[model samples]
Every structure is written in C-alpha cells, then in structure tokens.
Target: MRLKGNLSQIKNSRDNQNVDVELYIDKIEYITNKKDGRYTQPFEFVDELDTPLVLTGDCLARVQDKHLEEGEFAYQVYDKVEGEYVLNPDKYLELTVAYDFDADLTILTAAYYTVTVSNEEFKDIKAERSKEKKQKKGKGRKGRS
Candidate 1:
C-alpha cells in the first residue's frame, strides 16, 4: 500500500514530551506483515551499503491544530551506538507523525549525501584547517580604524 499526505506540525502523541514538526508523507511502501501483527517497512541508508532496514511503529500522533491545511513532518536521522546518538554520515530513516483532520498517519522520507574522499583524506583536511586557524590568530588587521 502507498500512502501520501501532508501533515500539520504538532505535538507527538506517542511521546508527548517532544513537539512534532509538520511534514509531508511523500511515499510509504508497505513491505510485509509480521506474525506479531506489525507491518514491515523498508528504510534505506545511503552509506550503510546493507539491505534496507525494516521498521515498524505507530507513526500516528495527536495534534492540537484543527484547521484543514497541508503541511510537512519534521524529521532527523541519527545513528545510535552504545546508547549514544551521533549524526549519521550517510542516509537514515525516521518515522514521523502527520495529521489530517481527525486521522493520524506515517510518512517516509529518504536523505542522502555523496562522499568522494576517504577517511585519511578527511584527517588531512582537518589538519590543514587547524593550521589555518593558528595562522589567522596571530595576524590582525594592522590599519583598523
């Protein structure tokens, strides 16, 4: 099943402690039905190079806004490792809440980036930046009025 819609930003009902942002459910492709009764959905991360990650959750969240309008869901991807969250260098998936009238829904979005350099190259780049910062610290505008 494919579902698409725009949701007004509001507070997330599943977790009321956090505020939900408005976002669009561009496309949602249903993968399979699990024996536990949850649906499997594919989520791909560009850098992982592994198969798409399957996710299942109740994306529907309650919102206070009632006016009929179209909006988008706010989302951010993170890599959780050893109980610490870090910004993923590649693509990641995040299920977000969206509301339409009295109905709640889920939206899937994919983010990606191209990295041409290797890890060693990145280290050299950082070293150059540190060197440049040191150089600039000792040099100031001599004729500043």
Candidate 2:
C-alpha cells in the first residue's frame, strides 16, 4: 500500500542531480486479526533495478499513527542495513489506565511523517529555501543609523 505522509528529510540527493525520488512500503501487519489482517508481512516495493524502496523519519511516524488509529497494534521500524521496514510491537502505544504500569512505562509516543516530492516540486522548494537563506544571511551585515 502506498502510505501517504508528510516529508521529513532527504539524504544524498543534491542540487543539479536528477534523482529518481523513489518511495517504498516495506510492509504492514496487525495483531489478533484486526481488520481481518489486511496487511502483508514484509511487503517489498522494489524497482526493476532491484533497488528497494524505503521509508524513513516522518514517513515512519505516519505509519505509527496509522497503527494507533487502527488498533494500537504493531509499528513499522526501518532497518538501514536491510533497507526495509519491519513491524515491531515494542513501539506500539497503549490505551490502558494511567496507573496500570510501574510508573516507569512511557505513555507518551512520538510520531513522524514523510512525503515524496516531484522533481519539479523539489526544485521549487529548494529555490524558495535558497531565497530565504540568502535573505537571512544578508540581515547579519546591516548597520544602524
């Protein structure tokens, strides 16, 4: 499934480079047959070149949010070496009572999101950021009367 999310960060891709902006859905899973087990375990989104697609940062954060909304089940954790997303329960959230734990269990969960930007859109965002950066740099040299 193409899980849509907001963009968090991009690595390696540089200006003047024609990067193919690839996105991937590692896989999704549920515990106890929630939604009749709609997701497949270890789903792969690979290109014809065998390069696997990946999700990171905010992209993963969105996945966690989806799991919480579904049934507070598993989470998608990305493995950099494997270049895949793994569904894990260690990071899942709980809706139990406030005093159900030993006072050391963390109830506050952190989430993230990521989105793919088209090459044209990427250029636009880069240009706007460049303009803002130039303006900020110029502000440091002004003299008061």
Candidate 3:
C-alpha cells in the first residue's frame, strides 16, 4: 500500500514533552500483477516545508487461513525530522508508503502510524490555534483551506 499526505502538525499529548504527529494520505495506487494475487502500490508524501524528512518504522504482517487479521497491525514511527536527524519529539513530519504484495488478492492491505517534529514558531502557532478553537462552544469552523 502507498500513502500520500501532508504533515499536518506535531502536538503535545498528555506529557508536554511528547508530541503526536498527524499525516494525511491523499492518494494510493495499485501496481503490478493486476491479474494475479499480487499488489503493487505507489504513493507520494506532501511536505509543508521544502526540506528533507526521515521516517522509521517496522513492517508487520499476519495471515490466518488466507485472510488478514484486522486491527492487529500497526507501524510505529520512532523518529521524523527535516534537514537533519534530531532526537527531539517536537517536530512536524509527513511521509508516503509504497508496497508490493505477492498473494492471490487483487488488493494488498496494510496500516501506518507516525510521529513528527517541527520548528518552534510553527509549534507555537499550532498551539495557539488549538487553544482558540477549544475555547469556542460549537464545532468551531469548517474547511481550513
């Protein structure tokens, strides 16, 4: 499976030090072996900033009687950054996943999860917006773009 999306933002979770990053997959394509049980996929990552970012995770798969187990899969991203590799958790990131499957199914199945980091200025702005929206009563607004 291939994923394409923007690295929305990095937000602090329960602990102010730990950040949770959001990624959106815009498009996914299936390539190769369209007739057989294999699946080929292509995807692109949309970055908010014009810089290089890194994403790291472990691949997982489980099959039971020719069927995949649902919700029993997860890809945990340990680090994500731009320009240089940093250990800090407060950063913004986005990425894409492309995969090939050698099975009898026309479509391949997979899941992805990520963490991200961003600069201080972007972080503050995101934080302020989050606060403002929460302060409102109704469902704030609609459609950012």
* Candidate 2 error regions (>4 Å): 1-111, 143-145
Prediction 2 TM-score vs. true: 0.27
Mind sharing the TM-score for model 1? 0.25
Q: List the residue pairs that clash in candidate 2.
A: 6-114, 6-115, 7-115, 58-112, 58-113, 58-114, 59-113, 59-114, 61-112
Error of 1 at 137 (Å): 64
Per-residue CA lDDT of candidate 2, range 9-51, in tens?
2222221121232244432212221133876333211112223
Task: Order the candidates by TM-score, highest first.
Answer: 2, 1, 3
What is candidate 3's lDDT per residue for 56-121, written digit by digit as tens? 221111112223243232232233335433343322222222333565222223433332323444
* lDDT over C-alpha atoms for residue 117 of model 3: 25
Model 3 compared with the native: what TM-score? 0.21
CA lDDT of each prediction against the hidden true structure: 0.36, 0.34, 0.31
- Note the clash tally of each candidate: 7, 9, 9
Cα shift from native, residue 52, model 1 (Å): 7.2
The lDDT leader among the candidates is 1
Better of 1 and 3 by TM-score: 1
